[model samples]
Target chain A: MSAQTLYDKLWASHVVREEADGTCLLYIDRHLVHEVTSPQAFEGLKLANRPLWRKDSVVSTADHNTPTDHWDQGIQDPISRLQVETLDANIAEFGARAYFPFKDPGQGIVHVMGPEQGATLPGMTVVCGDSHTSTHGAFGALAHGIGTSEVEHVMATQCLVAKKSKNMRVAVTGKLGDGVTAKDVALAVIGVIGTAGGTGYAIEFAGEAIAGLSVEGRMTLCNMAIEAGARSGLVAVDDKTIAYVQDRPLSPKGEAWDKAVAYWRTLVSDEGAHFDHEVVLDGAAIVPQLTWGTSPEMVVGIDGKVPDPAKEADPVKRAGMLRALEYMGLTAGTPMQEIGVDVVFIGSCTNSRIEDLREAAAVARGRKKAATVKRVLVVPGSGLVKRQAEAEGLDKVFTEAGFEWREPGCSMCLAMNADRLASGERCASTSNRNFEGRQGQGGRTHLVSPAMAAAAAVTGRFADVRTLA
Target chain B: MKAFTTLDALVCPLDRANVDTDAIIPKQFLKSIKRSGFGPNLFDEWRYLDHGEPGMDNAARPQNPDFVLNFPRYRGAEILLARENFGCGSSREHAPWALDDYGFRAVIAPSFADIFFSNSYKNGLLPIVLPAEVVDRLFAECEAKEGYRLTVDLPAQQVVTPDGTAFGFEITEHRKRCLLGGLDEIGLTLLHAADIRAFEEKRRADQPWLFA
Candidate 1:
């Protein structure tokens, strides 16, 4: 009986070479790219006049800078248009396929579209130049973000040099209470561990709470794994994972499916797996979380109070609290429940899945958005998610509640697309990262779960959605 | 560019928490990638006013008295004082490029988001991590004196004031070696050139079918 943590097992099997200072070169199975970071690397390739090392193993997409509205073949923003066009030309020239333009059924946020379209599989290592590449860990793959140069390196050579990080397991037990979603679970883990707690670690999600989540929910949980400061977050593939990818367009078929399932089923860490460190949380105890400060770690349950600057006994932490208060126009000890929201956004790779939409729609079923709330945007993660939501009439529910059911893409996730918060508007967002001015200049963002976003939309303040039901 | 290193330089002007990449470089200016001209646009909105275009010497301007970075004491700065979640949002490496291009050698913060933090390190910029209490003291000291200079020694794992006040910080030895060597990922790759070439030859020999 082999007793090993998932991280140790994964790292040991994948180790190609060990470097000085304890870094190991691990092989990468898949490499994904996007418009924002690919230009330079392609330029590097062009400079070298080298054909890509392998085209089949690499994929590209245009998501970060693409708008979610009607696909304008001629986009208005020249920078965005050129980047997209340049990438298109490069991919065509390289014989690499790329998902481009509006609402590509294969086109959605790269992280979401990758797994939904079966581009991501379990027991594989995936890397994207974008940080949220950790999102694919839901399928039990060790996925992490890489630099643009590394992207080119991987394009030129499929293998990557990686340091073997410490393995940690975060076990969240107990069933989630009503109004809590996968976004809440991820936020709860991050709040307890703080952002950098997982530094130099690969965290595995396990225990009853994680096992209970569906595949889409699992994706949401793993999407912001980087938020916890882990190199990647992974969950062992299970029936739920297999079911999700089984019938997808690009998934392995017939005999290939059998081989994939056989391999995936073997990916689970053995029982009694030992981890270097362990953290535990009870899902039932978690409330709707909202980030009151700039960092994702500076979060408290919706029913909690803003931390007192003085209470942060360490001077550096206290200074951080004070500065956060200044940027947020919030005071220490202010009740999070009393905070009012100027805008409500319920999309992003974090919470743009169909399950997130269903949860928001369930909350907004018979309700009208509060009069004070100015904007409510519901951007789905992928065209598939959008199509499924429309089939279920979830879009109608959102529209009736005064929310705009937008097309698929990474809309307003980082304000890379046209979607953004006007300056000074405090927004309740279902996205990760509430850094000061993340949405726009001087714009404040309070990160929360989708239901909380819907609740904020209905009442125009950071109200507790758990209490609404 | 006389071998200017982030070590012994760079401190935050305002002790701010969550000084995002946008604050490092606002979104509107992410329109190009020439890599030669982002310095003028760094902190464009905060340092300039209605009448000021990007090219003017921002330090000479009346300056937005209300802007967090424009406090009187920390003018002509090299160091930045920041709090947790510094450099959150979009993975555009350009954010750090703008800061590095615009004369920022180092950022002293209690914490940083993972992507931005790693990006900063790779771009020949130093990101110093000090305890929250130590960071607060630096902020207060920078605030107290006009043009107070702070020095950071990467090899010593300490930050010092002009008056020789020293504070210890944390960094992994691997990162220290990388920064001290001025090695980017390319440099990392070049280190293993022999091993890579040998591996390529071996792989080709083992799988003759894979080659042209």
Candidate 2:
């Protein structure tokens, strides 16, 4: 056997058949579905008169369109209500291994809920209709997003038609600075490697800085892989990964657990493995990061200034920067810290776990949200995460500091629900994307870490968390 | 999925890089369960001056005059010419769905995001990747002249400009065949039911805990 990358090993083990053209029918171990992308897929299945190949292979929830603030009011928007109801009806007719419908104690963002429930495990292939399915790759799983057509294909047959992705290694060595977290590391990686740098490749985040992160932190890094144009990202399994998967409801018990652990231990890449592309970054040099522009790649350290398009040599890139500046209402050479924010959103699949909430709450413990800031929303990733935050008094800390402690849903992340930004309203968000009109039709979103979002909430500007006394 | 063989259509040059899916079709319109009807809302925010919602009368909305799609010269354009890393955001297939519904049979770009590239093929929207220099030339030609159209011959794997300059593009034979024949991927994969079952059985024995 030749030395192989972890991605190669995972790819080989899952291959059911390989066509002459190099397309492989890869087996999917778990499928996570949500409201937004699954409806059309379900409709496709029904139109084709196809039955779900293996119902037990699926776990579903309604997160993207569910209201975060007013569950008691019961989804005021009629269209949003119908979408959630459609998911419930589809799951009832199609069946699933597990389902956490809206208001279910276990319900949360699919990416956050899957790993927390142990449904996303090591050395298996996980997929979802949502792009952030890469978040599950933190467990050393081969996970990626599939379009609705592929989603229907997976439902009809428990296999995905896939081609092997090139292997890319992003090695971040040295120690991270104080107040710099996984979100910063993820943003820094994107800043260094343009969004298309990892296209057609699966990136493995390794080295000392990666090894030092908690599993939740690893997920945050992997969640942003799609933003960098890669469909999937991975971290090799270790003691931390095993501990994270240890005793969840879906995890193997007793003898099975020991066997699973042994298998997972071999999930790392073999020495002398060849990679198609490689990038290296120093963790110590990475500061708290924020996207001053619309694209994730358009990020800079909090201490940096908004980029001037005139300095950009490439006309296409310069035009893009100019458009972003106009849309974000930013000026060239303006210090990032001086930019004010109207809203602070500290939730998304990217950073809404208990660890993220704890980080944000630590920054908001005694401080008040700035009077200039209109609203500060702190949404937990899952109902379980919300309960855990409440248990630790994190919710109280946020509420006392003038933040709205909301329910577990995507909320303003995509703003499919009522929680959204008004036109021209600038927001400091912990969500994955800062694309134009992402939060709302004309909203301006600046991507940052949970702690960074909290810092922005307190000061009503892009404040450096490290400078917070 | 519609079979895409050849297209010689007017080009609508959207000279932008990293156009994300959120901008392609806003999240607000994603509430619809059906795939159709997304065309009217395609590039919703960029095309219209006001906010767009599902079921809104698109004809009544004031069109952004500066938007290239609204230009009278590019009216009924069926091909979109774009910059690098087109369709570079969330994995909402709605981007391609919207483009296809809006009468775009093909899109030519310097590069494309992996997921969007694959999704485009599944929806019968040919995403042609050309060299950056070639794409730049095409954008220049498209912008310099009105009613400029390109002929995309997928079977020949070439995109021909009106001036007889043809640029070849690369695509996997498997994807090309699927698109040419309008094949159903799931139906085709199900042809190997026995192989899938055997592999599953072996996987269950090798990693029993996964089943447990």
Candidate 3:
């Protein structure tokens, strides 16, 4: 038999039909929805006068624009209120499987909640209206983001007509150094392959370094795969994946669980599987990484100096570097550790899991927030994660260190809510995307891992977590 | 959906690289799900000098004289010419919606992020991928001549300047057909409704527990 990559295996099994033009009608096992993108999609369904094809497969939530502070006080922003209310109405009318509204125990970021409830499973195709839907691929599911129009298409048809993506395997070899987390590996990969390098490919993370990551770590790795311009990122189903899924709230049980695991065990690529592109990284060489510029690709080691735009040969790249430096208030040759921050944000879909909180708490356990830092916010990805953190006293540690413990939502990541950075306020953020005004209008965001953000919170600068230890 | 057969319109050269969606439509303007009102807020941060909130009268906002869109010569332009990696962040279909709403029928760039490229086509906005040198040439021409116009013939897959210089591009036949026919994807999928129903029935029996 010919060799098949894991992506090919997953694509073939879910394809209902392949057309002459190379587009395949792929079956979607789960469809996740959030407030910001679904209203127009639901309106499309109404215009077509069609019912949802598979209500049982859809889960809806209000996350993107939900305020982290005073969420129960009722969303004060009228526009945000309308968007969230629209989702509640759309779900009720469409007969969605579950709708986690604001203040619900399960309410949180859609990508984070999907895996926690086991709606995302191995060998399935999961999709959401938001791009970070790639996060669910950590469960070995073929997951990716869809545009709002495609969201409407899926809601109406329960399928997506997608082109089969080329397979690329990024193998991280060697053992990771101390204080180097999965977030570091992700940043390292993005640094190696510039933001647009993975375009039109579905990446499979493989090899020893990947094998050592926990499910949460793998989720962090896959979460940023979109930042690399790959819509989907995957890791083959392993014991860690199975362990994470087994006995979860929505996972199959008893005989059904046995049948499911049996199928999942076969989800790995063939022994001689071929990939169209391969990138092998020496994991030992990676240090704690942080983005110094606007793009995810503009990263350096925590101790590295800021790059001078004059050194950049490409005129376009040089212009970008100059703009970023001016906006970020950074100077050429300034070490990252000397860059002071006005705020520290340590949670997002990328790093708000329990494991991420534990890592952050370890660094913030016995420290006080630097006087130079005006504010620090620690938000969990989901209410469940928040409760779990409080149970383990991680929340207490954060609050004791002058960090405000906030409710779960996509807060400060994009800052759609009121919790936003004022203009020119620099932040060491654990969220993805450092694009101009991503956190707020005229605000500057420096992307880092949760541990790095926590360390920055205590030190008021981009401090390497290893040095603090 | 509007049929996109050909477009002959004035070109606005946005000489920038990696023009992300956050810049295309800022986060503050993302609160509305209606999708129609985003035209005024397109490039909100760059186009206006003051902060823009929802329900604020766009006409009252102070226009940034430095922005390309505010220049009188580029006014009423329906085509955009830009540098590489345009529309590089977020899967907000609103980015394309804002362009379409603002009367842009096509975007010609050296390259585009995949999701934005896909979203552009789906929203009846033609995104033309030209070589970087060709894009640079177009940018130069647009700057040198005010109200510079380009004629894009979708069927011919070519963009022709006023001086008759032409640059050919490529598009998948499937996408081209959908655009030419003004076909709605949901309506087309409904044609296979019976087959979808049959597949779902068989799938349920094969994995009954999945329904739970």
Candidate 4:
């Protein structure tokens, strides 16, 4: 019905065949599983008395359930432990490679680890059990989250019943300011586009600012692309992307390297390629932003006031905003900067990369932790990042500034481990999602950039770090 | 698995709207790619909480006698009466598996979460959406009575009740065929084996340098 927008071309090329029922059976190039969703799939296989179809195609990691504090024990929480252990057994049984127990260099959030290890190559279709799996699209891949049933389906048969999605290219130009991080840019785009604007489409993130971001930051931006209801998000691989992958363990060497780069260079949208929809945002126009409501879309710049639900164009949205405000203990006209936070979390697949840490450390220098702030934790995304940062004294800087330099793990992203906001407490975070009770029951979350998070740790409120710097 | 359809008898309790998938299987249970374990954790908070069954408390306790699935009235329910926008979060296949594993054949709601709605048909879990008033009527009628039964015919796109009442359901023509034909991932692939083999062979020859 439309000219190929990279998505159609990819889908049409990858379609192994069409089922008699008219559903097309597409082959999956990669299947990444995490501790949270792999247990059931492995158990299902056991129940069916079958082994993994292609054990090598499957990749497993223990992130959601493992704790940064303990390496000897798998996880402290029973629920987290159960899921992680389930994944471990499943992978062991099927002979799939798994990164587990601790956030060693090989283990981190599935999306982060995949790219860092060069497993997320260009032109591949990646699906994981986590919604943020869209993060892989930063490498020019078609990636999205799949369900447990779909996971089992892929395991039993490396195929998926996929519907063709429309292509959308969102462009944001200009240079980002001193303090605004990739998270802010992403939040601003979603805020303007609304949460469901990209529904039924795969987003291609292009333009100068997007192209300027480091590979990890690009991944962080694409990670939340699904938040806007897009199938996935991508940037055409460039020098930055190629440089990031050159030294990775799985990256090709010598002869293979030349071939890989040549193919990777071809992963861009051809000229005159049309997108179903488009949105353009000027990067320099945005300030540091955060979410004050339950959804990521109800975001306001740090200097702005909480939106009045009464002004919302839709009734359902209005009611939702009101509910979010009530839960967040805020009212209309409340300045977002004045909001005090009890804790500050600087981790998640979204912002735990080395660049994110360095950005926060730059703000944390010469700044002491707030006496009123209960906890300021900085968890690196992977052991490699942790080791690299520590070697560079980044960890020392964070710790000296009263931040807890925790081990590499998905700490404080969810209550999967020991790090979680106590009920009724408010936190400044770098992770995506601010849904009610998302962190913990009755806990409030304000999604911000890493610099803003560090600033929150210093000032105990959402402050504009650029001014402080 | 056998396929059958009817929707007239499907009924749920008081209107619980916007049933997101996080509340269905939850982000907590999504750590693995497996589907079976989620059945136990389906609505883990709701199923064990007082809100779900009216008299349950202390979800952490070993015994909660008043949970919804533990209730007598809703026992052996083939059709599920759900609130609006059920299954609204991440396109995980586990949501449908959890629902299907728990023995729900069809989920009737005013609206369905987009991803979950698509996944339901693939997993053989029929998701039916009717007008809010119509759904409310069915829920009320069932609550007023008991053992409400609704039947759905995928080919006909209709749901039939015990008293000969009939209601039409909507589905994409393609998905409707998928459900009726009882096709799954492997089944779909097998149906196109010849074409797939040819495509693979041709690609292998055309891109000989690319194969590993």
Candidate 5:
């Protein structure tokens, strides 16, 4: 057989048919749904009088609009309440294979819940309406986010008409320094390649550095692939991936487990497979990165100073830098550590896993939050992660440091719930985007790792965690 | 879904790059289960001074004259002209919904985020990608003329200026067919139901745990 990249192999396995045009009808192995994007899709199905093609292939949860605090009281916002209610009604009517309603023990961010339950598997094709669905690609699945219309199409057909994407390889080499992490590596990659650099390509992250990361760490790396403009990012399946999925609730059992494992071992790319584009980065040179401007590309090392717009040669880029600087309320040439913060948010689909919380708890142990820091929140990605963190006493360490250990939901990341930044509040966030008013109407966000956020909570400013250690 | 064979519509120049979905329609408005009402709040933060809560009368709100959409000249524009990497954040189909509901039939940008580009075609909104220089020229022309417009001829794959200068563009034959026919994706996929069913049966036996 000819050499094939991992993505090419996965794509070929799922294709039902290739049309006269470039589109192919690819079968979906798993379709995950969330509250924010699925309502309209169900509504479309109702309008068209269509039945769900295969109910067993779909799973859902209510995450985006759920209030992290007062979970027992139910949703307070009228619109948020309606969205959750709509999902519940749709799940009942359509008969989804599984549904984790708000406040359920299994309820969490869709991306977090999928992997934790083993719904995402190696060599499978997974999709969801939320862009972070790429987080499932950590398991070597051909996963990506689809629009609501595509969501409706998947709901009705159990397949998607996908156009093949060019393959790119991002190879990170060398050992990571202390206090650096997958979030740092991801940020470093985005920093090297601008926000739009990965457009029109499916990136396979490779090399010794990628092979060394934990499954959770790999999820963090792939989760932010969308921020780099790539719809899907993949890491080849290995022993670590199989081990992580082995004992999960939905994983195979007995003789079936062995069969699945045998198939998964073949999911890796052949040694001589060709990639359309290649990027190589040195991992040791990377430090904990923080976004200074609006775009993820506008980043600098933790100890670096804000970039001067005057130094920018491109007029369009210069304008964006100026806008970000003005909106973020930072002066060019000022050290990033000098910038004070009002809130420190250390959760989201990106960095809210058990390992991420452990990193933050290590920094927060025996340290109290600074007087200038008003609010510090530690939200795990899912209820199961929350329970695991509590069992390990990471919640206690966080609460002692003045951080509120909230329920697992997309709290304050997009500010769909009551947990939001008031206008003009500056935050150190572990969430993906830092667009203007993303946290709130006029709030500012700075993206960082969980440890970095924890350090910011204690210092009330952007402090390098390396110094704290 | 509306078929897009040709449109001679006024162009609105939004001189910005990386305009994210959150800015297209803020998170507060996304709570609605319904998708159609987003247009009035499209670019809500930029277009209005006061906060836009659900059910608030859009007309009653104070409009920011400085915002591109609120300007008198570009009020009813059907085409949006923007810079590179437009729609770069969250995959809220609401971004295209808000754009479509706000009376826009098409968007022209130097480049577009992948998911947003796909969503636009599915929702009957044409996202045309042109070179940065061509986009810059269009922006200049729209700014210079009070009522500048472009005649988009989809069948010919050309955008013609008022002076008769034409710029050619390219799109996949599949997307072209869908846009021209206004074909619903779900309906299109249902036509291949037998193939989908056969594929699922094979998958069920291969990975029984996945179905469970």
Candidate 6:
């Protein structure tokens, strides 16, 4: 047998059939669902009179439409309320392996909850209707996002009709500088590759820097793969992967655990494997990164200045930068640190794990939010994450620093709920995207890491976390 | 699913690269359970001056005069001409649902993000990928001429311009067949139910932990 990449091995093992045109009916082992993308899919199943193939393969939760604040008050917006109710009705009608309702202890963003519950395992193919489904690929699973129609297809057939993506390796070597976290590495990668760089390929993060990252850090890296235009991002499984999956609620028990571990050990790429594309980055040179424009590719170090469109050679790109600067209320040559922010968001599927919260809390331990900063929101990824943070006194650390400790949901990430930015309000966010009107209509979002967001919260501007005492 | 054959219609040129899904259909409107009614809210932020919510009367909203979608000449245009990496962010099928509802039969672009491209096919919206230079030429031609239209022949795999210039595009045989037939992918895949079951059975025997 020829040496195979990790993607190749996963694709081959899951092939139920291959059509003449080279499309494969790939078997799906896990399907994670959230409120925003599932309603239409459930309706599709009902319209077609199709039954779910394997209820045991599905794990669902309501996150997007659930308000991160005021759980006791219930969802204030009627439309948001209906969406969450619709998911609950669908899950009740079609049973799943697990269904975490809005206030369920296990409830969280589907991407965060899936791996946290051990439902997302190594050497398996995972999917969700949300684009951030790539987050589960950090577990060495072949995970990617699907459309609502494909969600129905997966529901009815427990399989996906997929075309295999080409293999691309992004190897980051050398040591990361102080305060240069996984979010910085992800931003730096996007900066090098541009937004559409990995369009048709599955990127595998490798080399010494990738190996040194913790499991949560690996997840943060893979979470932004979608921002780089890749459907999936992966990392080969190792001891850290094994340890993370060992005692989770849904993990295999007793004899099955040993067998699963043995099989997962083989999930790595074979030596001498071929790759269609490869990129190398020096991690030591990467500083804390932030987005200066609407696109993730429009990123620079925290010390860098806003890019001048006059220096741009491409007219389209220059126009885009100009539009972004206007939308973000930024000037061409202004230093990034000089920019002030009205709000700071520290939550999303990208960062909101216990580690992310701890990182933010470390910076915000005793510091007070600047008077000019209107609000600082610290939303946990899951109810479990919230509970864990509270246990570690991380919630107190945030609240003591004048931050609002909120419940678990994708708060202010897409801002489908009431937690959103006002018109023209500038926010330092730990979320994934910086697109125009993403946080809210006319709201400006600057993408940064959890610590960066905390630092911005304390100083009311983009502050360098490394320079702190 | 409506079968897509050929579309000869006026072109609306959207001269922007990386037009993300959020720009196509904003998140606020995604609360709907049904796929219809999204067309009115398509490019809501860019198309209108005020912020758009789900139940707001789009008819009363002040339209952005500069937006191409609002231009009198581009009204009722069924073909959208766009630049590179159109539909670049988020996996919301609402983007295509909105495009289809807005009466766009086909979108010709330099490139498309993978997920949006796949979702477009499922909703009967044909996404045609042309070279960047060819797309540039189309944009220039569409802007220069009023009521400029193009004919997309899916069966022939060519996009024909008003001046009789035809540019070829690629589509897989399986996708082409499905699109032409207005076929349901779930039904098509279920034809091989036995194959799927066999594969599952083999996996269960080999890696029993997955089933557990």
The best candidate in terms of DockQ: 6
Model 3 pairs whose backbones collide: none
Worst 10 residues of 2 chain B by lDDT: B203-212
- Give the per-residue lDDT of model 4 (tens digit) for B22-100: 5576555555434454565666555653222112243453434455565678767767886665665566676787788
Candidate 5 C-alpha lDDT tens digits along A272-365:
9989999999988889999998888999999899999999999999999999999998899999999999999989999999999999999999
- In the range A190-263, model 1's lDDT, one tens digit per residue, is 88988778876788999898999998888888887788877689898899988888877567778667866887
Order of models, best lDDT first: 6, 2, 5, 3, 1, 4
Model 1 DockQ, alpha carbons vs. true complex: 0.26
lDDT of 6 by residue, B36-119 (tens): 999999999999999888888999999999999999999999999998889998999999999999999999999999999999
Q: What shift in Å separates residue A364 of candidate 1 from its native position after superposition?
A: 1.8
The per-residue C-alpha lDDT of model 5 at residue B63 equals 93
Candidate 5 lDDT score at position A330:
88
Model 4, span A222-255: residue lDDT tens: 9888777665787887888888888676666787
Mind giving the per-residue lDDT tens digits that candidate 3 earns over A31-65?
A: 99999989999998898798998998998778888
Worst 10 residues of 2 chain A by lDDT: A68-77
Task: Judge candidate 6 against the unseen true structure and give its global Cα lDDT, from 0 to 1.
Answer: 0.94
Better of 4 and 6 by DockQ: 6
The segments of candidate 2 whose C-alpha lies over 4 angstroms from its true place after superposition are none
TM-score of each: 0.87, 0.99, 0.98, 0.87, 0.99, 0.99
Model 2, range B25-117, lDDT digits (tens) per residue? 899988888889899999989999998888889999999999988989998999999988999888899999999999999999999999899
- CA lDDT of each candidate? 0.75, 0.93, 0.90, 0.75, 0.92, 0.94
Determine which window of 10 residues in candidate 5 chain B has minimal summed lDDT: B203-212
TM-score of 6: 0.99
